[model samples]
Target: MSQRSIKITMSAVLLAAATLASTAPAGAAHGGEPLTDVRVATHFDLAAGQMPENITLLPDGTAAVTFAAGRQVALVSPGGGTRILATLPAPADGGVHTPVLGFPLTTGIARTPDGTVYVLYATGTADLTGLWRLRPGQDPQRIAALPADGLPNGLALDAHGRTLYITDSVLGTVWTVPTTGGTPTAWSTASELAPTGFLGANGAKVRGGALWVTNLDRGTLLRIPIRSGNRAGAPQVKASGMAGIDDFAFTGRGNEVLAALNAPNTVVRIRPDGTSTTVLDAADGLQNPTSVALRGKDVYVLSAAYTTAADPNLLRAHLRGHR
Candidate 1:
């Protein structure tokens, strides 16, 4: 990336962070009841110099995390132990540098039932932008190439696991590729997906027979019906008014979801009826929560804590009262 582009990108991200800091409430409490039994599972200080961004839990009770600054994929054992699973090649310039904080690169990850892992990264270089997959004992393989301007940030897989959906934050476009390997096609590109600045669609998922995505800049959650022949129906807003929405996960209820509000460091629960409530916030000690994952009755959150990467964390909280 050129110096001019880097300046523009950094300014946008800084502005978003500043906006959240200025407007968000300082305390931990929100209107709704807070989530229960919140605990820290892992802290980045142990993985020194690494900034953990996104996570995908493996079937064997371990989590695969993408270290945006460390440039690697690591497995976090249930006991809080972490080890590098695969080291991705360093991207050009290794992403932009910001004082005190870490780079804003390499953010999303997903795993197939068969143990295959998919990662999204942007190096501001043509050949290094898009999704890559790592099979057991195999090297990282580029599955598809996104546009040069694409900033791929979140990933999701369909029910049959035949298709993979990726969200591009910079371009506000969603691309789909066959899980087993095929041409990546533009799945959706409506006006609703347009980027307001640097963030457009940040996180995506397939649940309850439809494709759901979050617009980080718009503060809206959009639902698009998955029609016959793998096509997308007209998009509709499911929920909005969120701040710095990054990634989200379903709560296993009808249409309820948990979202990470990065700027203010909060997690919110959104219902199918479009109502939202804070489930966790700064009072809960959350700092730049980037993504949320659920396993059984427990919810896991990964925080980037952009203010300083020294203590970014992985937190666990009990799932409660979602019907």
Candidate 2:
């Protein structure tokens, strides 16, 4: 089957599951307090290929985002002004060699305090498949080489900004590389990161001395400790039952997180105890929320509209008393 067909089939299955889950009694599938003042901050141009796949926040409150299909990196200011920072070169065959998705796309992104940006690109070809770095006033450069056959998805930077942890969905592996860029090391290949039939290891973050990741196919959140020698320890299941989960953000209140459920068209708050509740849904302008980022009480969500085929937008909301 074609990639598009596979995506549609997966969406249908996940949508049905979400529908049933949504009907569950309160505090069961939906438990946490929903967000407030949810509003669209910016509506992207679908025709122009401006679907945002992932996002990272800058100190100035601007969001650095990767336009997945467009293969571009852009900055959206707090006031909703957008500026294209860089666009990756298109593959000669127009990404026909790409795996899984069968098309070239940018995925996870992270920014450093010094204005350096790192993003992941998957093309199923060696030349342009790996991590890219963009320094202030300079063009983007491919830093490390990843497996052409694997789909590199979510990314996270350690607290000191000296290391980068990347998740490969197709390979069911977590890779570690220096921020400066070099050969990547297979950090972990736990069974939990493996995909059941579709994508896995979708979103990743580093916090509290641990690397947290989400498995889309497994519908789980996993935590792997940063053991001695900067190695990955045993994988621990943090949360489960959230099918179609994409990217997530730490709410800073312990292990509480707001995760985007792509095909389900919702954002859920998952607590440390594995309980989760619907915090935002399609009514909040989410067309297939791909990622979430939080700054203080402010929340940002990027919806790609991949399956919805409607509005791909950036949404802002308040967490209501969250510091």
Candidate 1 C-alpha RMSD relative to the actual structure: 4.0
Compute each candidate's TM-score over C-alphas: 0.88, 0.93
Clashing pairs in 1: 28-283
Off by over 4 Å in 2: 1-34
Candidate 1 local lDDT, 1-323, one digit each (tens) = 33334334434574675485456443334665546789888887524435677888887678898876566788889888988888777655655432112243566899988899998877666676678888998998877877656778889999998889888777778889887766679988887887776577878889877789888777789998889998988889998777578788887887888888887668888878887777787767677788988877778898876653336788888876643
Full-model lDDT for every candidate: 0.75, 0.87
lDDT of 2 by residue, 89-174 (tens): 88887786776676788999998888899999998889999999999889889999999999999999998999999999989999
Which residue runs does candidate 1 get wrong by more than 4 Å?
Answer: 1-14, 17-34, 46-49, 92-104, 308-310, 321-323
**Candidate 1: minimum summed lDDT over ten consecutive residues — where?**
95-104
Counting clashing residue pairs in each candidate, in order, gives: 1, 1
